[model samples]
Target chain A: MSSKISNALRWIGFTSLEPLLKLIRGEEPKKNGLLVFKKLLVPILSVFIFLGVCNAGAKYLYNIERERKIENTRSVQGEEAAQQMADCIDSGDISCKPNSLPSPADVWSGAKTLVEDHKMITADKKEFKEKTAAINKKRKKQGKSPIEYTGRPSFVDQIITSLKTVFAGFLLAALIAIPAGIVLGLSETLRSGLNWVIQIFKPVSPVVWLLLVSMVIKTILANADMDKSFVISFISVGLCSMWATLVNTSMGVSSVDKDYLNVSKVLRLGVLSNVFKVVLPASVPLIFTGLRITLSVAWMVLIAIELLAQSPGLGSFVWEEFQNGSSDSNAKIIVAMFVIGGIGFLLDRIMMFVQKMVSFDSKA
Target chain B: MESVIEKKTMLECKDIKKAYPTPKGDFVVLEDFQLQVKEEEFISIIGHSGCGKSTLLTMVAGLNDITAGDILLDGTAIAGAGPDRAVVFQSPSLFPWMTALDNVLLGVKQVFPHATKKQREDICKYYLNKVGLGDAFHKKANDLSQGMKQRVGIARAFALKPKVLLLDEPFGMLDSMTRVELQDVLIDVWSKEKITAIMVTHDVDEAIFLSDRVIMMTGGPYAKVGDIAHIGLERPRERHAVLEHPDFYKYRQHLLTFLDH
Candidate 1:
């Protein structure tokens, strides 16, 4: 039972828990206790200390700003001006207002409000569907299209949309890069021929890629009435992120053990079987490493692409809040920052799980 | 000896030459190398390092292109590596990802695609058991010891049922005990199958114990066979008996003399 728990923890990326579980089972508790202290207890204590420091620092800054505002009012006018400054500060109407860095409590409240807003939008969507059902039935009977909901997308909807776009872009990149990488890996002449082109395009920025993609897509999709921003953003993401996978895959393929190649030759395996059985399997670990890097790059570039294209995503949300400059906008932006970071971390873990699945090397 | 020569000629290397282009100019490694083997004869090529014995074996396996001349198997010129010629490299060279059974099965299935999966698996299991790797059939190559890995390599090569077997210092990496154990296993399999075999080695004792005829090569820059010593020991020779044989020292001295020059 203890071994089972250890294995489960290892599989879930919580290998630090194994020592604790072992200690619970009374299997070398002293050693495991030391491991637990180092891996778990110390880190937890450090996080608490950090949060405490942040809390105290934020309060100290808030008091200093309030005192400064009151002193400035006293110097400019008389007791009336000072009293008004104190009142404005108490009411949270100082000039600095909500533009200051948000405290942890503010971010917490901001996340709560976003969740509530998501729930309200979901309820509104349900109501809209019910109301449109009757009209849609009549319109369908008359061979007319039903009306679509044109309300602003909620925060949750934008997160889902961004995820969908990144996946589409990543899939496109893999589709093009993996096969091209294999071919370049197999043929020396081809690799040399295309090396310059790859080198030139690999370092191009995501913003530049977006501009070029938009210009080309605009010309090609001139008459098509579609979500041009969505298409443009995803294509740009794919272009900017594909280089890592391509370069890594080629290197992996080229460096496959020469003996394995001899084994294939001695067995007289056909070209296609040789690739699938030998080349692909041998290079899978490196290829997956490449894929992980590509996914992270895609996520990093996605926000810039979305902001420039004005697409509906967390990037646009942050940009919009920055422009809005209201009392709560700073807190909301902080919340979005945490959400984006959390999603990036989750994407990386998912890729690691996939890498483990495809590779035979247990060390990975 | 007369009866042995009466048997059919199985393989031949005629006027073989190999050279590499270095910055210094043409660096010749082997020149005018030639040999012939009768059917089912076990021939071991013994030489010091840089003697081009491995280059000769690789040419027969069709892995390396000869700069001049040709190699023939069963009266037909061979070109390029194929299932007809299987090689066991010095290192095990088994795919680290595959199990011992699966490594052998890969060769069996590839060479005999017309056979059913069960038949191919049985062939693989049979060879694996013959090499004393029955218990390690499911173990990955990486998990196996150096000796066990080489056994799997032998199983893989033998499973293909190739017309000719090539061994490039197959037991060079093992300790002495494992080396003797594997050499016995190899002899048992070779005696049962009677396939034409060529092994290149630097071990003088190994060459004498395993081969019907030991060919000693001169040192490089362009090395050639300096002498061929025939072992007339009877069939089913035991390792201890071969070591104690009267003619053993004579053949050893002849090989040592040729190598020293």
Candidate 2:
């Protein structure tokens, strides 16, 4: 049982936990204890130290800004005016722009409020559903359809929207890039012919892609009542991020071992079988590396694309909060920043899991 | 007295030449390389490095394109790589993702498409067991040691049931102890199957232990067959007995002298 657990942990890349599990099974406790300390304890301690530094830094900056505001008011008005300004700064007034740099505590409170807001939105949705059902029953008798609920999206809703858009973009990228990469890798002539095009388009900025996609989509879908911004944002993300997958896949396919190819030939395998059996399996490691990079690029560019397209996502949430400029708006935006960063880390871990599953390289 | 029956030739290489085009000019690796083997005969090619022994073997396997002349298997001119000619490379080129059984099954299924899935699987398992890898059927190529990987490679080739097996120094990467062990395994399988075999090797003792005839190639810029020594050693030859034989040293001296020049 312990061995099975150890194997599972090793496969999932939690190799450090294996020693601890072994120690629990009464196998060299002292050695495993040292490993546990080095791997787990050290990282936890480092994180606490970092948080301590950030807390101290935030407090120091807040005090400095508060003092500067008081001094400015005193110089502009009289001593009486300065005291009122100091009181307002102490009370966390929104008028002071310098106070917008929220402390860690403020961001924490902002996160709590967002959670509460999500719960309230859920309650509202339930109530709306019940009300709609009653109204629909009455409308059915009158031969009328029920009205749709178009409420403001909660923070969680925006996050879900962002995830959906990014996935759509990544799917689009994979559908187009992989086949194209395979063809390019197989034929040197085709690769050379298309090299200039790939080179030119690869480095194009996400903002540029968004603008181009928006222009094209707007004209094409002018008559259709579709979600224009959603389509534009995802398409832009796909265009901006696909180059990594394409380049890496081509390189992977081109560098498959010659001996494996010979094996395929000797087996008298058809072209399709040769590719599936020999080319694809041999190049899986490199192709996964490419996919991981492509996913990360898609995530990074998603915010800019969403902001430019004004799509309903975490990116737009951040942008909207910034424009609103309310007292809690800064804290909310900071909350979104942390959320984005956390999601990005999660996305990378997911990709790493998938890459490990597919790759034959044990070290991966 | 035993009835005399003429053995038909299984493989023939007639004035084969292999050359690669370099920027300077055409670099000739092998010229007029020739050999013939009777049915079910084990032939080993021994030479120093750069003698184009491997190139010649690959040419027979239909992996490398012949610049001139032709190689025939059972009176038919062999063209591209086919299921009839299976090769075991020096590096044990098993697909890393596949388990030992799957690696063997891949070739078996490809060659014997009409066979039932159970039959194909049985063929793979049988050959893998023959190579002393019965327990490692589920072990991926990467998980296996170098010797084990080569064993899987041998199993894969044998499972295909090719008319002629070409080995390009299949045990070259292994240590001396493992190489000797695998050579014994190869001899056991070859004698049991009685398949026509052509092996390239740098090891003289290995060639002598495994082959009925050893062909020595001269050093290159255009290497050719220098000598062919027929081993008159008895079948099922034990390693200790072969070492003790007076004829063993004579054949070793003959091959060593050819390789030295």
Candidate 3:
């Protein structure tokens, strides 16, 4: 219940902050309300009018294209189904009952069957209309269409799930990365040794890691007589992604000032409190830098892993659409690409926001 | 001033000697350097460029070992660097990540471990304000100018409430005006805190201005305190007027001739 007030306060804070920010930016306030609207009128109206016209134009074109495709598909399937049913009746095949009408599966099969029958084709308006009418009647009564059972996740659902996974995984990685980086960064031997490991693995391709892990998981499952491919993929990709975080953490630790170390010694601050208060605050800039780099790496790797392994992620959604070879697939792929790029851009921006928040007061 | 005058002698260094092992045999910086500081005495050691005045101060601060004799604080020999003897180093040795208040609090909290959190905070703020850095207390040490940073360092050292405050050319890098201002501030704080302070510098006027007794060391290989001038100038002495005093100029010229050797 308190969340309601908090949300209201948050909204108010933002609303009130707008004018203050405008003041800081030195924007002059309108003496009369009409002047504000007058200043905004041209750009706002032009943008809305352009958007409205584009949206209307797009909707009209889409409706026309959809109607054409729907007409084409219905006629094509209806003629094929009718021809097959007639042939079956002539042959006294009782299972091919044309009077009862065909299922979508049967209609689809019939379309393939009647692909060779060329006489009752397009340009024959009466035949096409009659066929479409039969298909529509069948669809209304029979409760099925002649579309296939495509095993693809819906684009919107895929987006939500992928976003959830990325955030959860990135958070987990960060939680693990900070402490681990501190430990590695503080120890000289660990820093050097780990740096060597990073040098070897950081630049190696994510696709290569995905392929190797997939093959390894396949071999392991075959040997164990168990199928646990998901766990293996996550482990492989997680490790590949964690490298940036680990290296960055170590770097942060290594770069703490000599005077701070002396201060800690002189003050006799206990290790736990010292690490939390002094070391952590001092190393934040580098830590966030690492997190940013690692986050991007993890995202890129997750997509590559999903695409290569056919895992249930955004990558798989895009791949499945491209593989389907439908006329709509190219447009869907374009939409999916935009969605992927937007999500990545948003993730990096979030990291940048966090960096700003953490490092803001450090300057004085 | 009453408290400082009434304070007892807290530390004394007796006939201390320090030598470094070199290929050409032992090179001595100071030999039989005897200094007995009463409680709250403002003492300055001035000498030639490499006369090991800093080395002498460090040994007394327990940062370095004395070869011959020992340093005693209230009749006990100093073993190592401790809270009772805080040193303000030449360089601004503040933790860059910590704010001025936090840097001061580092020493306060450590020395008075049983003090309440609010008490420590107040103490830190009080000392920082005493050093005229009340406004810059929240600023990070690194962001401060060199003079301001040194003030923070001085605040940190004095917050320890040390029996012996050792300074190794604390204002060496500052400009003349800043150096004079800090010297006055140092004098004011010393008069108030009454902590026994031993500052090492090459500035002749600084020694005459600040110290109760100015110990001038001769040039090293084996330098010793060649002359000890008792600066009998009155309290609240003006620098220009004091320089024109017959006795002040006499002491300065005597030290200049002695240092020429």
Candidate 4:
């Protein structure tokens, strides 16, 4: 049972805890202690060191900006105004503090504010729903749409929106890339013919894709009732991130072992059967690698596309916070930054897990 | 000897030539290659490296284009690769993602299209067990060792029930001891199916042990049949008994001498 738990912990990539678990079970304390130091204590020390550096840096930058403001006040106005400015800056006033880089505590408080704001909004939304429930039921019976709250979204809502947009773009890329990659892999002629197009489009900037998508999407979806900015953001994200999957899939498909192909030929398998049963299964490892890269790329580009396209997601949230330029706004931006990074990491782990589930070769 | 009723010809390779155009001119690998395989006859082609033995087998299997003449299977001209001819390659060709049973069932399904699902599975299970892989049916091909993978490959080919079985150095990658074990397993299975078989090999002892006739080929720019030694050893060949047979050394000497040139 201990061996099984150790194996599970290693598989889960929580190897540090394996030694700790062993220590808890009172098996080999000295060796496990050394492992615990190497794995757990060292990483914890590094994190504290990082926070310490951030605290010092934020303090240094704030002091420099505050001194510059005080100097400017003395030069422009008088010593009295300069002393008054110093007093204001020292009073922990939000209006006068330099919002250069947020301290760790500032970020913590910013996250707290966002959570409380989300709670307030939830209460308001629930009250609005209760007030409209009877009218909505009547409207439903009459085949009319129910009323929706038009209030602002919270930080968590923006994260959920970003996730939705990223998933949509990722799905679009897979749907387009996998089939196109299979076709390209199957035929040398098609691969060569389309090679230039892939090479040219693969490295195009997400901001540029957003510009292009906007022009085309507006023209195409002008009469449609759907969200135009959402469509543009997701389409641009898809176009920006699909290249990795396309290239990897084609390479994987074309490089299938000759012996496997011989088996297919000898079996007289139909084209579809040959592709799905032989080609796809053989190429799955490469295909999933491409997909993992595509998902991560999709996420990285989504923020830029959302910022440009005015989509209501983390990208737009960060953009708004930057422009709002409140004393607390920089801390909020930092929070969003960490949230974006955390979500990207989670997305990659999810893709890796899915890849492990599908591929058979243990070495992969 | 006369009571060995004359078996009818099942496969005929007549004037088949394979040529590849190089920078200078056409390089002929094999020209005017001719042979006839009697029904249920096991024929092994023995040659040195680059002697076009594999070329002839692949041509007969309809994988390579016959540049000059025709290959007739039971009177019909062979066109392309089909289930009527199953090949066991030197490398394990089982799909790495599929289990051993699934790999065998892949070929069984293609050949027995009208067979019930249960019957197809039964065929796969039966062949896998015949290859002594009864415990490893659920293991993926990538998980199997080189020798075990070859066992799955042999199981897959036999499950097809093909009219002609082409063995291209099938035991070339196995260790000597595993080679002998798989050879015995092969002979045991062949005695039951007894399809027309053609194998290309570098081992003289393997040729003598398994094949009824061993055909030696000349070295190439244009390789051809140099000599044919008929093995009159009795049915249900045992390895130890075949090794101890007096005429076995004679056939082995004949093949080795031809390959030495």
| Native contacts retained, all candidates in order | 0.72, 0.97, 0.22, 0.88
- For residues A40-141, write the lDDT of model 3, one tens digit per residue: 455579877865675565556645644554455458787666565455545745453222222233334443433323223323434555657767677768
DockQ, prediction 3: 0.22
TM-score-best of 1 and 3: 1
Q: For candidate 1 chain B, which ten residues in a row score worst on lDDT?
A: B1-10
Deviation of model 2 at B80, angstroms: 1.4
| Model 2 lDDT per residue over A305-347, tens place | 8887889999999999999887788789989988998998888
Comparing 2 and 4 on TM-score, the stronger one: 4
| Model 4: residues with Cα > 4 Å off, grouped in runs | A1-4, A7-11, A26-35, A138-144, B2-4
Tell me the tens digit of each residue's lDDT in model 3 across B1-261.
Answer: 334446566777788788999999999988877777877678889988888898887777656778998788988987866767788878877866678898888778889989999999999898888889989988987689999999998888889888888888999989989998898788878778878888898888888888888888878867787888888887666778887889888878877887777
Q: Which of candidates 3 and 4 is the stronger one according to DockQ? A: 4
Instruction: Please report the candidate that would top DockQ against the real structure.
Output: 2
Per-model TM against the reference? 0.93, 0.93, 0.63, 0.95
Candidate that would win on TM-score = 4
Model 1 root-mean-square deviation = 2.5
| Residue-pair clashes per candidate | 0, 0, 1, 0
Model 2: what TM-score? 0.93
Query: Sorted on DockQ, highest at the top, how do the candidates line up?
Result: 2, 4, 1, 3
Which 10-residue window of candidate 2 chain A scores lowest in summed lDDT? A92-101
Give the Å shift of residue A267 in candidate 4. 0.7
